[model samples]
Target: MTKVINIQPVTRIEGHARIAIHLDDDGNVNDAFLHIMSLRGFEKFIEGRPAEEVPRIVNRICGICPWMHHLSSNKAVDGCFGVTPTPTGHKLRELCQTMAHINDKILHFFSLQLPISFSGRIVILRFGMSLESLKRRLNLQPRL
Candidate 1:
């Protein structure tokens, strides 16, 4: 006989998903796959869009797709219109985008580096292990 196993709303992701598994006659697992149920219509939302809205729309989508879609799209629109953004306008937008992306970079740095630092201290306290041993366990370096 065949069977269906369903898991709904899987965790640790931005959206909802479902996982399904199929089982064969002997009760051994046969196959499995994940399915995403949410669609934000991002493509449709962008079609026929005013160029000025690109930044705002892309900013809404996810973490970071186009870093400065608004400013970039505005520049493209300026090209299409055969005009230039004033030095002041361009610089201001650039500054704003740069600041936003920098903040994101700082957050990423902490997310990536802070845990490694703290984890080493934690391991040292708990197990009194050496860096070489930890590295070996993590497969980051060969055994000494």
Candidate 2:
């Protein structure tokens, strides 16, 4: 007799996958298979949009890596049209991409640490509004 062990919907990562392990009569590890069960569908999503608009539109695919998708789509579209960026233009985009990667890393690091450190404590997120304003809004500061 043989049995299969299935692990579905993997976590701690962006996408989905399934892993299956099969056992032989002896119960030792027989074989394993990995099945990718998720797709981003950026192709179908971007098909009807104008090429010029793709850089901005493809950005909606993933919030964390939007800048990478934005720049890559733009470069691919340019190549499709037989256009090449100027040396300075290429350098600038590369610089901006490096900076975007750095920004994403810092934000993700803070987010992953927030729950462990803060627990249920007062917290304010979102862009704009100063720390003092957030403290006041959340009533964390002592009343005057």
Candidate 3:
């Protein structure tokens, strides 16, 4: 008989999601799926709002990637207004977006990937340890 394991409210990230692991009759893993259930009505919420304010309002779509939402909203508003950003302005926006990407990657590595990767091997420290100590324990070298 086939079986399924459902893990709900996946932590260490924004919004609600779940993971479904399907098992074969012999108990071997068959397939898996990730379901995201966070669909806020930003479209309706932003109706009739000023173009300049839309970016700020829509940035709340995802706490972890708010800059993405903000930048996308700005692009949409720019298209609607038929306006183009200056070269410097464009460069600044790209810099901010890149920084946001890096921030998200670091947060995910620390909060989600590390724990999942070392699920059974992670040691629980009664007293907190330094980042360098933790990296040494994990045998992870700093990457440039």
* RMSD to truth, every model: 8.7, 8.1, 6.4
* Model 3 lDDT per residue over 32-130, tens place: 999998788888989889989999998898888999999998999999999999999999999999999998987777655674565434334323788
In model 3, what is the error at residue 33, expressed in angstroms?
6.3
Q: What lDDT is obtained when candidate 1 is compared to the true structure?
A: 0.66
Name the candidate that leads on lDDT: 3
All candidates: TM-score: 0.46, 0.60, 0.69
Q: Kindly give the stretch of ten consecutive residues in candidate 1 with the minimal lDDT sum.
A: 118-127
Model 1 Cα lDDT, one tens digit per residue, 76-115:
6788679987899878888988887986665544444333
Model number with the top TM-score: 3
| Between candidates 1 and 2, the lDDT winner | 2
The clash count of every prediction, one per candidate, is: 1, 0, 0
Residue 104 miss distance in model 3 (angstroms): 1.7
* Backbone clashes in model 3, listed as residue pairs: none
lDDT of 1 at 124: 23
Off by over 4 Å in 1: 63-144
lDDT against the true structure, per candidate, is 0.66, 0.75, 0.82
lDDT of 3 at 32: 97
Which pairs of residues collide in model 2? none
